[model samples]
Target chain A: MSRSTPLRGVHESLGATLTDFAGWQMPLRYGSESAEHNAVRTAAGLFDLSHMGEIFVVGAQAGEALDRALVGHLSVLAPGRARYTMIVNETGGILDDLIVYRLDEDQYMVVANASNYALVARELADRVRGYDARVTDRSDEYALVAVQGPRSAEILTALTDADLDDLKYYAIVPGVVAGTPALIARTGYTGEDGFELFVLNEHAVPLWNALAEAGKDAGLVPAGLSARDTLRLEAGMPLYGNELSAAITPFDAGLGRVVRFDKPGDFVGKAALERAAENGTRRRLVGLVARGRRVPRHGYPVTREGAVVGEVTSGAPSQSLGRPIAMAYVDEGALEKGSLAVDIRGSQEPVDVVDLPFYRRSK
Target chain B: MSTIPDDLSYTKEHEWVAGIEDGLTVTVGITAYAAEQLGDVVYVEVHSEVGSTVAAGDAVGEVESTKSVSDIFAPVGGEVVEINSAVVDNPSLVNSDPYGEGWLFRVRVEEEPEDLLSAAEYTALTSGES
Candidate 1:
């Protein structure tokens, strides 16, 4: 039996192709994937992301407990602010990458990947057994929706009383959306101006309908996971199962900036990260752009000359750029930008190693 | 759903075969159902060439979309005669008119085609049996 999100019926009504992802049956596309991807890049698009995991940490020692659990210092995060953090195991391998939001002095919410919800909740709960904080898994009760693109703010501000102009990037505010109490966060996986609204499961239908009506003239279309993958890859954002896993470290995954070594508390995998920093990481993630419409796919071997050097973790033809691009984890010394080849179904296709982001929004 | 043309014979794998040149040659392409499932074919790769003898169920080409990559198999044993260059440049033709202008290849039959499902049989294969 597959689980359904709060917006499952809405997706089905729009003639979306459904597939199982992270134990939830979600939409893969609606009509055409390229149209949805281009809509998010050029205009605006909405996504139902309620399948993500939401965990809450409460009590007086919440900040202290979070500091001991992840790599970042959550204590310094001011109220109404959010920071991207990582939870690692004893061997400096990433358990899951999450975003920490300081709801109040003693209250914090951690949003994580849907597939790693149980593991993250269990690990955090066990780590804080002696602390005063309590971990509560709130994934089922909440629903998340993302409105992303260049005109996202213009459309979203009409339905909420919150001051959208003051909400800086990586900020969160307690507010009401469509007459329902919700948490509106200025964060998204797509590299665009966007807001993530978390509302009660029962309120999702009304909120989605309200946003769709308000955003109709602004060129907002309902997008699915297929467009989400291509948009994030163009923005150089790493997907958890693709670019990150239990065996991948922060340094190797191009996420070293999220780690704080000078913090006063000893977090999990602190010593191992220190050692990894001293001796450089073995592999590094890089971006590759193919010459034509043939996109390099996941698990495709990346070779230089005739020697296999790495494998593509994510690849897609960017609807915004009209070309093929990918991300691959290669040796640290092989990070130089040059000519490369991607094995596409027993044939080698020429590629160029350029900068991280394949496309950037014009200001 | 569009009705499968009575003149064409279909396989269980959703490939359509139409007799050409008085049954000496046949044109092959994916059925409309297969093209609909494979949204927006971006690339098509042909592995077999002219004059190469192939067996039924052998992979002759591959079609890639934004979501998946699928193998295009031979519906009947034949010698490859011609490949469709138009679909290679504009793969959306497969979705528009799969049985007509979207034909994939032409082949010379090695023997009389057998074990193929008819249009009605192919429709039954996709009609909510699962």
Candidate 2:
């Protein structure tokens, strides 16, 4: 049986369609996914992201230990700030994409995807063994709730007197909401201004209800994993398994910028990453806008002149773009010179290779 | 529970047939249960051309949703007479009103297929599955 999040009862109460995702029974959507997707773009949407893993690294050498464990230099990241980074194997193969938040001088919290967090926690534990730091998996103790969209700040401010204005993008501030202690972060996967709330499991339901009541006038609807996926895709965010995997390196995904070789330490995959960077990758990730209504899906072969060139990673009917959009890894040369078409079923549907991020919210 | 009109016949594949009892002419569409399962319908394609004979249980068309896609099957052996152009333009009608405005095609039946379920049986089949 798949594990349930702390807010499973709340989802049941709302009659959500529950699906087993990454070993967790999570809500796919409460109602129409298009409405939820549009709500986040127009107003706001609430999310129960408790299924995400939270691993804490603390003690004197926590900073030093992380420098060797991951690609980004967490030690140099200012307190209350978070940076998107990756964990890699010895051959520079990506294990998972992570967001590490530096809470204090000797403390940091690493948020990882649900599918790969267990191994990530184990990797962090083993990598930090030589240092005077301790790695603890606090996933069971915490439940994450996110209020995402243009009206996220007002909805959150309605619940707490916390300084939402002081919080900049990618910054975290400790606050209390509905009498429940929470760490509010000004970050989200959706291409909109939003806040992610980290709170104890005991406070999950009450806090969700409180936010629902407070956000009623502000037009905040409960969103699910389906909307989250489409939102992230529109924002051009790479999911771990889809865009990053052990078989692929960061440079192959056009994410060489995430690796910080200048960080003052010998990190895992440093040498292999340097080699990969210098050699350059063969395939590059690109966005494909469908000329037809047929949506290209995962594992669909991208073709050039009736020959298989690459495969699609993630795809969806983009509500914002009003067309089908997909991410695919194609040969760099073919991407420039070759006229490409995705073999959707048996038909070769022509596509326009565009830049990443099919949608971006105006500030 | 999805509404299965007493006047319609249903397939285990989650399609609904109308006017089967009136004559050989009948309208076919996917049931609301299928539309609900498929989520938002973004693209739809019908295969059988006008005046073409299609065997019962043959794959005739396809409905593509945002997350997944399903094949639309012929309810009874018949010749395709007309297609619904409105649903072809706005596929969201499948979710909005699966039984009426979202009709896939009209078929002039060559022969009535056996073992098509009534409204009661279709409801019984889908109610448990959901």
For this target, which candidate reaches the highest DockQ against the unseen true structure? 2
TM-score of each: 0.95, 0.99
Q: How well docked is model 2, in DockQ terms?
A: 0.84
Scored against the true structure, residue A238 in model 1 reaches a CA lDDT of 89
lDDT tens readout by residue for model 1, A1-363: 889999999998998888899999998888778888888887899999999999999999999899999999998899899999999999899999999999999999999998898899999998887899999999999999999999999998999999999999899999988798899999998899899999989999999999999999999999999999999999999899999998988998989988899888799999999888788777779888898668898999998775677899999877766678899987655556445789987788988887788777776
Q: What is the TM-score of chain A alone in each candidate?
A: 0.98, 0.99
lDDT of 2 by residue, A1-363 (tens): 799999999999998889889999999999899999999999999999999999999999998899999998888889999999999999999999999998998999999999999999999999999899999999989999999999999899878878889999999978999889999899899989999999999999999999999998888999999999999999999988898899899999999998999889799999999999999978999999999999999999999999888999999999999999999999887887868999988999999999988999998
Count clashes in each candidate, considering only residues at least 3 apart in sequence or on different chains: 0, 0
TM-score of chain A of 2: 0.99
Fnat for each model = 0.53, 0.76
For model 1, name the residue pairs that clash.
none
Compose the digit string of candidate 2's lDDT tens values, residues B18-128.
998877789999998898888889888897888999999999999998789889899899899999999999999999999999999999999778979999999999989
